[model samples]
Target: MILYIEQEILLDTQCQDLYLCNNGLNNEYLLISSSNQCSCKKVQAIFCKYDHDSCKNRCLLEEHLLIKRKKQTNSILINDSPANVVLLNKNELEKNSEIVFICHENNLPSPILEHLKNLINDRSNATPNPSLHQTLIGNFLLKHSVLAQSAYGMYLKLQQTRDNKFQLRRHANIGYLLANILLGFLCSFILYRNFDLYQLISNEILIQTENLTTSIKSIIEWLMHAPAGLKLNQPLVDFLARFYFYHIYLWSGYLEVLVVTVVPYFYKILFILCLLGISLAIGAICDFIRLLTIHLYCFYIYAARLFNWQIRLLIILFRLFCGKKQNPLRNNRLDSHLCDIDQLFIVTLSFTIFLFLLPSIFMYYAVFTSIWTITILTVKLIQSMNQFLLQIPIYEFYLWSTGSGIIRGTPRLSINYADSTEDTVCYNFNFDPVSFITLYRVCNIRLSLFSLSFSKLFLGILKGKSIV
Candidate 1:
């Protein structure tokens, strides 16, 4: 059978008697051609001519051809004859165009076509199944590997479609900011009106301050004795104890004055902070804690400076003993030098004195260093928590959870083979909910700031720099 589909209608070259029949009900035109008797009685060959002009109406023609072909196919099947089904593009039929055969149905009962279709179907529907080993190792790598996270992040970024407009995000941010401001004002108003609540807070601060002062005094006295059952030079220990105790007394006197003066106005300061924002108020509280522990910080600095100075002198004396001197003109590089017997004696004596004094200096440095570190970490932890609260996208998460369409993600396409037959396939499109990982990355939190490097901390302390 030979078929020519055109804009108006077309006639077969062999059988010019073919007629064009238009169905009045559906307003569709069908070309009805008479079958020609051929030499191959069992085999039927069909030829089709498609034009560029009719390409726009390909869907309609395709449907009509399928219906007509089905009817002829049923008859051929009844007769147990061989047949072939082919679809060609208009470009392929033109001069210098390539000839392509879409499908060839033979009566030899070949399973190649069925096998190929099954393979394609299975591939399309395949889901990943990781082995137990792979699952465990992959999870570990993902958590600990920076490269893995970066690669996954890049893959997600590529999957996401670019959308420059951020009206929804902007609106959400504005709403959150307004809500925060309103809540801050309400809190400030409540605190300002409630006198007893602020008075209690003030009393609590004074009590904590007094307790801190008493604790410091007791710790100093304990150290003056053999702390941790270690023997120490009594005269040096007593001198250091008296030094710390004097500072503690001074700090206590200062706190006593502050309790009568500045501490009474603590609530007023809190009210002012609350008016700014809850996050600001939290930050202010952290700052207040640091301020209260300023004496500890000062003690740490003094101990670190004294220890570093002693260390520097001992290093110089050791170099003198090694017959080497630091060349100040050459960036403090070591240079060989011959020292006299007198110089050697003086270097050895100084080195011994400094080394013996190191135990007392180290003891004070360690104690104050620990106290300062604890105070700093507590303040930093509070600040980090405040920052996390401020940066978290709670509103966005709520919108996504509610399916409000405010948060959009990439749409995934799925093929629905249930509605599909041998001739046509159906496609379904849907969108998956945005992942929490994506939301977290969007926030860009600086978690690395909290990461500690012990080497860097030790170097900084040796260099007489502030650790905090």
Candidate 2:
């Protein structure tokens, strides 16, 4: 029997040709299997270090476990738990799904096994559950939502298993990516801080300030000796020069004074706070711009369908004649375009147009990109500080026995002889990290919506766009 394979064109050559069993008869199986393997050479190399059994067993095992976990996860009774798992992040979903691990415990008392299930059934409805973010860390021992939910699911599976509790724990990679990002951010900041970028900005501003001050002094001298008729005729230029000299002088000199004079004295307290605020504001502005641009891109895509006829016609015309076929490198007319355009031509055209129009965007883009990079460094530093210096334990439920309550012999369960430890109990666990991620994401979205509404209200009032 023949097999049919369907795939779209890839823009990059890095992940194109690498595959196992290039002409195997089991083409379907190969396709299914290879879908799970990393196409990137770098990722495969990383995978090879820990993946024994020639990566075959690991790849096969990953698919088998993920499928079983998905079945188990879907079979779960949503009505009983009613965990609202809202998935907004693509990375979180993929990463969390790949992290399903199985754990088993044998030789346990019946009550202990049963109690474990009960613990899983009960969620922490505690009032003081806190976020571990450095900006929002509280006094309470806050468990990460993913970890907490995983523990809960594991407890539930333990009760359902036939012999013993078999736990499926999905915590793949275990925050290594986030940790690496934090590390990289730190390294970049250390390198950048050594470069003294802020000193450069301050210095540049000082030089311009000095030059402008000198020019203003010359202008004033020229004006002092000039005729009243010429001064009247050039009153606008005189006013602007004087106004700019005072205004720009204050802005340029203040930072210089702060950095050159008072910063050494109050570096830790006042100056640092000022810098941090300025940095945060700049980062937030950059992020806002990025978000807005992305929103506009989405809007542009939808505008093809949603916009009025005149606008729609213009967009379609631009897209249709983008002329992907014009490239001599292209083999056929069917060869796809880059984002619906001829990449080489569009890029050159965009560069030309950017130079002529909206060049301010490019100027701000470079400055903000650097500032945001530093802000990310600050964020990483804060996250690391919280992780290292601050010890926030994951809150867990523990059982205690009372001295007054006397207990009889331990409870036991009779099973088949094949199942050894007949008078013993066992436990199974299944921890679905996805559920906790979804829950946290949902809460975060709600929080974001609330904050957005509040900010919009405040901004409207400030702009005199709404009720006082």
The digit string of per-residue lDDT tens for model 1 on 6-41 reads 212222222122332322322222222221211111
Residue-level lDDT of model 2, residues 41-119, one tens digit each, is 1112111212134344544654421111012121111112211111111222122221121111243322222223332
User: Largest TM-score belongs to which candidate?
Assistant: 1
Per-candidate local distance difference test = 0.52, 0.29
Q: Distance (Å) between predicted and true CA of 354, model 2?
A: 44
TM-score of each: 0.59, 0.23
For candidate 2, the TM-score is 0.23
lDDT of 1 at 103: 17
Score candidate 2 by lDDT: 0.29
